[model samples]
Target: MTQSMEDFITDAFEQNYERIRLETGRAVTPNIKEAAREQVLLYYRRMRDVADGVTDTEVKLTLPEQRTPQQRKFTLEGVVDIVREGDRTTMYDVKTHLDADAAAGQLDQYVQQLNLYAHIWQGLRGEALDETAIIATRPTRELRQALRSGDDRVIDAAILKWRPCLNIPLDEHAVEDTVQRFGTVVDRIEERHFMPPAVEKLKAPIRPGARQPFGTAVCANCDVRFTCDSYRQFRLQTTPGMNPERVLQDAMNEYAASSEQGQWVDANMETLNRDRLPDAEDIDRGDV
Candidate 1:
């Protein structure tokens, strides 16, 4: 329910790092807040190698004040974590996953998001980025051990575990495709159309072992599942005669994972270290 360390690092670091990053982008450089500056310092120390060739961090495609202009231009708004701008612009996004395979499966989404940044860059700079990269940071067992014990070893292991990937960069065709894809979704929303990506529930006992049904990966974090009629119907008809107690247990599990905003959600914003990553080399990719 809470934000992961990965998310926290991204956000907190951005808030601090952007002072210098944006200043370098603009003419008049301003001082960043103290709290934010500390985060930036910690990040550079922990992940020093990534600091190389890093022209900028926390670059935003659409500023809050620029929204009207951006929407008027029918643009996609996004943030690019790192940018190496020169004869050719290179973009990078930071990702955190359990492993390389888990990070690999999310390629399409990352590519599309990066493409939005490319479009924004081209609109402002008159040229598109040449390529994009993903910097996936996955904690290993030893790092987990270091984390649990708050040992200094975590600082070094974290740097060694980072995985860099060169992915398909945004081109003319990709930008056009992105525009069309977003357009289709916008049009559907305007038309009030609906397409529930239905998932098939299994006829198993109420094990409730954090195993999300296939095709319902989105549901695992969705708050509406608590009230979704479709989910309810599927659960009732296909739970293999699970009793009321079992059903209650399933709901409790959903509550634990739900990201929907509420008071409880606000209070649970601390990251869960134990749920960071499974230790087993061949562990099934459950929502754990």
Candidate 2:
């Protein structure tokens, strides 16, 4: 499906926001992705006895109609590995190929997917779910640790805060008002010729010993490797000018200097350090 502009912006904002929270030790959203992963793991935990068991199962959850004029109705597609022993109602998502460490690292993405599904599940079950998890065979030890460290309360709280953004108020004139505001912004940008600031010109160049990796976790499975300029340059050169190490150092220095002088940095340094820098490895895996 074609991506929406709002979705892209929202993803970017959430990623940066979460990263800042992690780096600065600020309380942000709990790891929803890990929660979903645990839900999948739980499904597999039930089927340890059945060898050569179920490959894939899809669960469709239907929700009740809402009183809102623009309520969103969607479906939750759950891939299950096993059904619980006695109830057969609960299921799990087992990770067979994806490693636990890797999954844990990408838990945010998983949580986003799970929360998306949970929204649909709530609609279907006509009640809020207490918890949802995933199951995986690989990284057994890592997965076990993750399960123990899982926190549903945090995930639920994050979801509550996130719900408003997900389900934007779509009352009368909402669409028109948004369109009008967008037009105004476009006009303003056009009036200024849409030129990027000088500092924004710092491009992402590739360097040596860089490994550009992409997967389902980040970039939503988009083939951004080819499209990312840093990736291509990293493949060709041993020293890409815009290596993340240099970039991060520059950002940190700039932030420190700004703070020392009581100057506003304008950019969210915490967000950049936590989120964007880490992802830079995936986009341009070159050593600084």
Task: Specify the highest-TM-score model's number.
Answer: 1
Instruction: Residues 1-288, candidate 2: write the lDDT tens digits.
Output: 123533554566568656756667543223433444444334333333432233335664433332222233322244433333443333344455554444555454455445544555444455434445554344334344544556766444432332110111112323334334444545555466443222212222112232323322222233444344443333334345677666445533532364443322223354354455445676586643
**In model 1, what is the error at residue 241, expressed in angstroms?**
6.1
Candidate 1 segments exceeding 4 Å error: 1-47, 51-53, 62-74, 85-88, 95-103, 136-159, 162-166, 200-217, 229-241, 257-288
Residue range 122-226, candidate 1, lDDT tens digits: 776565567877765544344445556765676556545544444755655576566667767666666676565543432222224434342243454466665
- Residue 237's lDDT in candidate 2: 43
TM-score of candidate 2 relative to the true fold = 0.31
Please report, as a residue range, the 10-residue window in candidate 1 with the lowest summed lDDT: 26-35
Q: Clashing pairs in model 1?
A: none
Report the Cα lDDT for residue 80, model 2.
Answer: 35
Cα RMSDs, all models:
15.5, 21.2
Candidate 2, which segments miss by more than 4 Å at Cα?
A: 1-56, 61-78, 85-90, 94-97, 126-130, 136-224, 234-288
